[model samples]
Target: MINRTKLCSTVVAVSALLAATTNLDAQKAFNSSDHYLAQPLIKNIYTADPSAHVFKGKIYIYPSHDVEAGVKENDNGDHFDMRDYHILSMSSIPGKVTDHGVALSVKDISWAGRQLWAPDAAYKNGTYYLYFPVKDKQDVFKIGVATSKSPTGPFKAQPKPIEGSFSIDPAVFTDTDGNSYMYFGGIWGGQLQRWSNGKYDENGSKTDLGKADEPALTAKVAKMSKNMLEFDGPVRDVQIVDKEGKPLLTKDHNRRFFEGGWMHKYKGKYYFSYSTGDTHLLAYAIGDNPFGPFTYEGIFMNPVEGWTTHHSIVEFKGKWYIFYHDTQLSGKTHLRNIKVAELKHNADGTISMVETYKK
Candidate 1:
C-alpha cells in the first residue's frame, strides 16, 4: 500500500537533515571560546610539573602524576612514584582537548624501570624526541631519551641512559646554527652542553652561575662526537654578578641561585630565563650568544598570593608567551599548575609578564 520510492526519498532527506544539525552543533562547540587559563585542562585530580610543546599544530603536555584511585599503587603508596610520564595532547585552540591516555609509561620500558619526572618533548623532521629524568631504586637520578615517529606515541627508549650523567630536569634547545644542546641540573648546579647523535658532552659547566655576587655569567661552547653525546669544547666561565647584590631568602631556606633554565631568541638577542631563591621566583638574563657572557636582567614575576613559581616559556602563533607553574592549588608536592602570560619587552630592554587568557 505504501510507495517504496517515496519512502526511500523521505528517509534520505531526514538523514541529511540530522547530519547537518550535528555538524552545526560541533562547529558551535569548537568555535565557542571559554576561559581555560584559570581552569585545569584535565581534571585527573592530580597533575603537576607540566611541560608543553607544540608539534604540527597540536599542543602536547607531559605532566607528572602521583596517584589515581583506579590505578594500582606501588610499594611507596603512590599510584605512580613520579617514575612514569604521561602525555596529553589537545588542539591549540580553546575547547578542543583530545587526551591520548597514558601515551608513554616507564613500565613499558625496561631501561628506566623506576621513576620518570619533568618530561620535555620536541619534534624534528619526522621524529619526536622526549627528554625526561629517571631514577633507579639505588636513588641515583639520570636523564633518558625516548623517540617516537609521532607526538602521541609508544616512545621507545635507548638501551641505556643517554649521556651517562647524574642529571635531572633535561631541556633541549636547537640553536640558530642547527646545533642542539641540553641544559640540565638543579639542586647541585646546572650545565650546558652540546648534544650530538645520542650523547651529551660538557661544553661548559656552571658551578655557581647564579651566585648573587658573581660578576658575570659565563658559558663555553663544545662539540660532541658523531654519536652526539660527547663533549669536545673547553670549559669557560662568563661573568654574571650584581654589583649591589640583593640577597634572596625564604621563610625556611637561604636563597642561592639556579633552577629551571629556559631560553628563547627574539629580535636578534637571546634571553635565558631561570628561577632563584627559596621562593623560586622567575628571573632572567640576556646574552649575545646562546652560551653567554650574560647579565642578570632581574625578576620577571614574584610569588603572587604566596605561591612560588617555576620557569617555562614558549612562542605560540607569532606571540611570545611564558608558561610557569604555581603552588596555589596543592601545597605539599608543589602540585604545580601551568599558567601562561603574554611577554612584553620594554623600551629600556626590560621584560614584563602578563596573565594569559583562555579565550
Candidate 2:
C-alpha cells in the first residue's frame, strides 16, 4: 500500500497525461533494422503488457486495455485499474493492426473483481484459450481462462479462476510433445510478495522479505490439465540461478525474475525470459527442461521510457519479433503503447541484446 498523498499525485499525473495525449496523432511505421525506435502497433487506445503469438499464419496480441480509471496508485497496483480486454491482430508486422474490440469485460465475468491484467493465448484441439489474471471478489489475483472459436474473439471467460492459481501475468507454453505449462508471478503491488509461503498471507511484506542476501522470490509454474481449464499438478517455484547454480539473491535485481513470464524454445533449449521489474530489464535463462532450474543468461532488453516493461516474443513468418510497451505514447507511466522489434538468435543459442531506448 502507498500513502494517500502519493496515490492522489499518481492518479492526477496520469489523468493529466491522458488528457494531453488522447488527441495526438499516431506514431510512425515500424523499422525492422532499428526497432529500438519502433512505432506502436495500436494507437486508438492505450495498451500494455503485450502477449504476442502466431496462430493460423497470423499475428495476434492479447494485452490489457489501458484506460484512465482515476483510481489512485499503490504498491498493490490499485492505479492500474483496467476493466476489460481487446484483441489485436495483423497479417504482418509493420502492417495495419485491427482491434477486435471488447473480448471480455468485468461485467461479463461473474466472479471477477476489477483490474484485468496481462493476458496470453494458446490454440489447442480446435479451440483458442485466453489465459489472464484478474482480481476475484476477495481482491486476490487469480489466473483465469476464456475460450473462443476464432483466434480473434469476444471470448467467454470461465465461470471461475483456475483452482490452484495465484498472482498475475499468465504465460502459457505448449511444448513439442503437446504438453502445456504456465509461468506466472509479479511482486510489489502485483501481490507476488504475499505468496512466499505457497499460500496467501494478507499481512505479508508488500515488496519482498527485505532480505537482500537471500534468494529472490521465484516465479510459479504448473502443467495444465488436458481440458486446459485446470492445473494438472501442484504449482511449483521456478528457480533462476547463476552459471554456478546459485539462486539469484534478492539484491541482484538486474537479472532476477520479476514479472512478465515469456517462454520460448530455440534449438532444444527452454528459454524462459521475464521482466526484472524494479530494475526494468528483460532478462532470460535457459534449461534442458520446461520445469526449469534455468541457468541465468543475461539481459536482452534495456528499460523503456516507463517504469514497467512487459513483453512477449513469438516467431512470425520464420522471423522472431518481440512485442513490448513504452511510455512514449502518453509520457505517463500508467499509460503505454505497444511496439514490436525483430529478434536475432546467435549460432550458440544466445540472444542479441535489445536496447529499447537508444540515442
Best by TM-score: 2
Q: What is candidate 1's CA lDDT for residue 96?
A: 57
lDDT of 2 by residue, 1-359 (tens): 33555644654465346433432311221223243468778789999999998898899999988888787766677878888888999998889999999888888888898789999999999999999899999888998999999988889999999999999999999999999999998987778889887789888877763566679997999999988889999999999999999999976777877889889998899999999876667999999999999999998887676668899989888899999998666866688899998899998899998866445
- The candidate scoring highest on lDDT is 2
Checking candidate 2 for backbone clashes, the offending pairs are 75-189
Model 2: runs farther than 4 Å from truth?
A: 1-36
Clashes of 2: 1
